[model samples]
Target: MTDIRLFQGPELLDHAVALHSVYVDAFCAPPWNEDAEQAIEFLGSLRVAVRRPGFTAALAFGGREVVGFATAWTTLAPFPTDRCYPRAAAGLGPERTVDWLCGAREIDELAVRPQAHGTGLAADLLEAVAEDAPDGRSWLLTSLRSPRAMSFYRGQGWTQATHPSPDGEGIVVFLGPRHPAGALAAQPL
Candidate 1:
């Protein structure tokens, strides 16, 4: 059986190495194909991310080994310009970006070790971090390159808010099930 725990603020750093291992296991293979440098960079970013307002994280452990994890925080106003934030904002436009995303809970990352893929651990971790989201306003951005990931979130009831390019090779934004603007998303062709 897997045990899941929630951590808030910088306290999450206590298990940094273990969490990094789970991250590498979940993302460095197959469709993701991320490298060691990217994993190291994630560690560095986690340090800063944990300090963001409303930051929360959930980790799944099996016999003292981390098998999955998820992180989230409240999105602030003006919207960010870095990372994939710009892509999300561009897709939603300035008005919806601020009105729908700002002040909402933003799920930053969710990863489950390959061995734990079919065990429902990913969904548990996602809910653990987002359980307290304000008004159930939550959102996330995922790569369209991974059809499995896209399917997983959709199966979890998240609504796809952004339409990917014809080649389906870009970031796609998803609004959590209860997001007020979920009905505003454009249906895919």
Candidate 2:
């Protein structure tokens, strides 16, 4: 049996190491190829991210070990000026991007251990982290290279957005329910 735990704000700080370990284990494989040093840097970034408004996280445990996890927070109003967000915002355009994402929850991370794959843990963690979004609005970005990941998101009712990630990172954007993008995507061609 898998046990799942939900964490918010300050409570997330306590599980920082465990979360990082899961992230490193999950992303360091195949398409991501992130190194331990990069994972540590991500941990540093996570420390600040959890402090943001509407931060939330969920973790799945197999016995005493972390097997999967997810994290998210509300997107910024003007959008972020740093990293790939600006490029992503540019691709989505100002109005739709802000309207759908500004106050909407953005799932920042989701990972599952190799041994725990195909056990439905990822979906459970995703649901837990996104369950509290106001009006059911939520979104996320993932690599275009990960077919399995993209397929899983699609299978879970996530809609792909027209915007592409900046920096040629092969990033693909997805919007959950109640997002304007979903309506746009559903319209007849």
Candidate 3:
């Protein structure tokens, strides 16, 4: 079994950097690397998610080195709304425009080191996050173009939602029992 720990303070920042590095190696997506500005943005988002309430960051270590990390939250704002609030709430009254956000769990981000990519580390990281969540529907968004990524969710039995990516690209949402094997129902160890 992989050892996991709850991240605190700058610990999240450290993982965010590791996550940034691995993301570049795995995807080479422009925004993930070769773009200093984009890398900064990506790291900023990761740092934010790790610090949010009900949000937990899990890092896996191979004895002495931090090989991978995943971060998620117990609540999420609905799409369009979730995506827009950070932009639209610039001037609206907090009691008004912000009221729409309530009672939603969000798996904001998850990334595994390229060196540890094929070791089932990603699934284990997600499983740990799910294990900590209270019984309830949860959701995550993954690139639909990446069949491997999509398959990973399908294996976990995530249901497809109607929401499509703003870019018109496929993006599927998943909400299901934390565990299909019934292991998730067991008492916390």
- Assess each prediction's global lDDT (C-alpha) against the native: 0.91, 0.82, 0.57
RMSD of candidates 1 onward, in order: 0.9, 2.5, 8.2
Q: Tens-digit lDDT track for model 1 on 47-91?
A: 999999999999898989888899999999879999999989988
| TM-scores for candidates 1 onward, in order | 0.97, 0.91, 0.68
Clashes of each: 0, 0, 4
Candidate 1, residue 78: the lDDT equals 77
Tens-place lDDT digits, model 3, residues 1-189: 467776644566755556777556555652233465655677777766666767777788777666766677755343235553333333223442223223435565666666776788887877666665555545566655666776677687654432344463445545445523232222213
Model 2: runs farther than 4 Å from truth? Answer: 163-168, 178-180, 186-189
Worst 10 residues of 3 by lDDT: 179-188
Better of 1 and 2 by lDDT: 1
* Poorly placed runs, candidate 1 (over 4 Å): none
**Deviation (Å) of 5 in candidate 1:** 0.8
Inter-residue clash pairs, candidate 3: 74-105, 75-104, 75-105, 76-104
Task: Give the per-residue lDDT digits (tens) of candidate 2, residues 1-189.
Answer: 999998888777788788888888898878889888899988888888879989988888889888888889988788888866865676578887788788899999999998888888888888898877878889998877787898899888888785454344567678885565687753213
In angstroms, how far off is 46's CA in candidate 1? 0.2
State which candidate, 1 or 3, has the greater lDDT.
Answer: 1
Using lDDT as the measure, name the better of candidate 2 and candidate 3.
Answer: 2
